[model samples]
Target: MTIKKKSRVTSLAAGRPPTARKPKSISRKATKALINTHHVLEKKKAQAIAKGDRAAEIAIESEIDALGGIEKYQLASLQGQRLDRGGDSSHILMEWLNSMDSTISSSAGAHLKMLEVGALSTKNACSASGFFDVERIDLNSQSDGILQQDFMKRPLPKDDSERFDIISLSLVLNFVPDAMGRGAMLLRTLDFLKQPDTQYSSGLRTFFPSLFMVLPAPCVTNSRYMNESHLETIMNALGYVKAQSKITHKLVYHLWVRKSGVQCPPATFKKTELRPGHSRNNFAVVLSGSSG
Candidate 1:
């Protein structure tokens, strides 16, 4: 969804205290319903366009409107992310960062800059850690700190000063409706990451520039066209090497370091099925042209 900037109007002074304004608890079932319905409608719309079925495309649009549009989908997603709901993925990221050497804290001359895409709240673990200087953005801003902007529309960095040490795509890649767009999004991260250099020489802490990504477990585990090995192949092709990963029953988290001079895989990736099953999903990441 393309989000336009809107004035943030609030009655905080007269309303209840800020802590009392928490997102109301949403049932897991209801949240899943909203998110699933939105994905289905978006997929149908994409298929209609592919087949040149204008009538079907219009029908899908109406269905989406009836579902309360992208705003409703975003709200459901945000609710699902509330800390009480096992929504914040940054806790895993923080764990990985703490395990790394030469840790950079606020005391360091510079904090590691992070571009957090699809950020839902300004209070996630990463924001509170005091280790990262985060730039939060989302397609639809739910709070004051997150900028209402699409990651694809973000301007390209001019040089090192404009780049970041890490880019977090927590549950954001799966939000793109199409596979090709997902691949493009991954590649785009490389452009925003700092180029390899001697550790601490530039006042930055040790460690390579990295991409921290989180996705629904099914996107890899139960997809017809993608699996763990396939995903690793794709990332390796893009000059990334997995540094850490943790897979749960519902979610998968990965941290891929941007390697300095590795060559991309010899072949391109497409939606060819790697696993055949009627229940498998269509999740895929298809790269066009060269990777990295």
Candidate 2:
């Protein structure tokens, strides 16, 4: 018999402190569900491999996809979300940040006017966790030094004339449950960038800003993670280009820039094969030739 699935919003509770344990318990439940499904699939995958049943293996892999991204969605939907996405993601992000230090320092004329969406009510918003100056904004969390508003709702920063120097979305796209929702967020993210009209040849623009998007592994199919390699393709369709990219087992990361005089109609992708070397945990950073 088919069983009922819990709604994503069911994992959340209202009017609770960020330190509340009941909500954490709810997240553990979601994590448990994902772990059980993962173990079962691992066994089935091994069995299929032994029998040389490739089709069976593929089918079981499809079943595993159903549980994919749920752990992250639950975390994003839970209380006291962190800059690290509640696991080892912080280590990978730190390395990525260190790699950027020289680049950021050399861009002499560039300045940072940054904003971080879904920045939880934690003591350190994602950027500040690493001591960066990004301002945090969260609709559901209490504002520390950051703003509190919904990105898709009546957010104060949603104006067409308004823009920032940097916008960061960390492990946020996967939490969206549907393609349209994810697309909507992507478009909205673009809206906050300075328009390309004033873009600089070797520096930043007058009003437009760069973007950094971090996606979790085991991502839900057809979600924003599709932009990993096809970022230029997707962003070009949106009048933007990929400024940079870093893909690993833990995440799909990108930096984007808007194109001058380009206005694009919406583009849609129905399916995509995820990058290989499946992540062992939601936040593990697997070395290129090494498994986590």
Best by lDDT: 1
Model 2 C-alpha RMSD vs. true structure (Å) is 13.5
Error of 1 at 223 (Å): 0.9
Model 2 lDDT tens row, 105-180: 5766655556777665444434444434566776555445657667777454555345666677776654443445
Q: Native-vs-model 1 lDDT?
A: 0.83
Cα shift from native, residue 267, model 2 (Å): 4.0
For every model shown, what is its TM-score relative to the native structure? 0.86, 0.53
Candidate 1: residue 261 lDDT (0-100): 40
User: Where does candidate 2 stray beyond 4 Å?
Assistant: 1-111, 121-126, 129-133, 156-161, 199-208, 220-232, 261-292
- Residue 154 in model 2: lDDT: 40
Candidate 1: C-alpha RMSD after superposition: 7.1
Q: What are the lDDT scores of the predictions, listed in order? A: 0.83, 0.54
Candidate 1 ranges with C-alpha deviation above 4 Å:
1-23, 198-207, 261-267
Question: Once model 2 is optimally superposed onto the true structure by TM-score, how far is the C-alpha of residue 131 displaced, in angstroms?
Answer: 8.5
Best by TM-score: 1
Candidate 1 per-residue lDDT, tens place, 59-104, comes to: 9999999997887787798787777788589999888777653446
- Report residue 261 deviation for candidate 2 (angstroms): 5.3
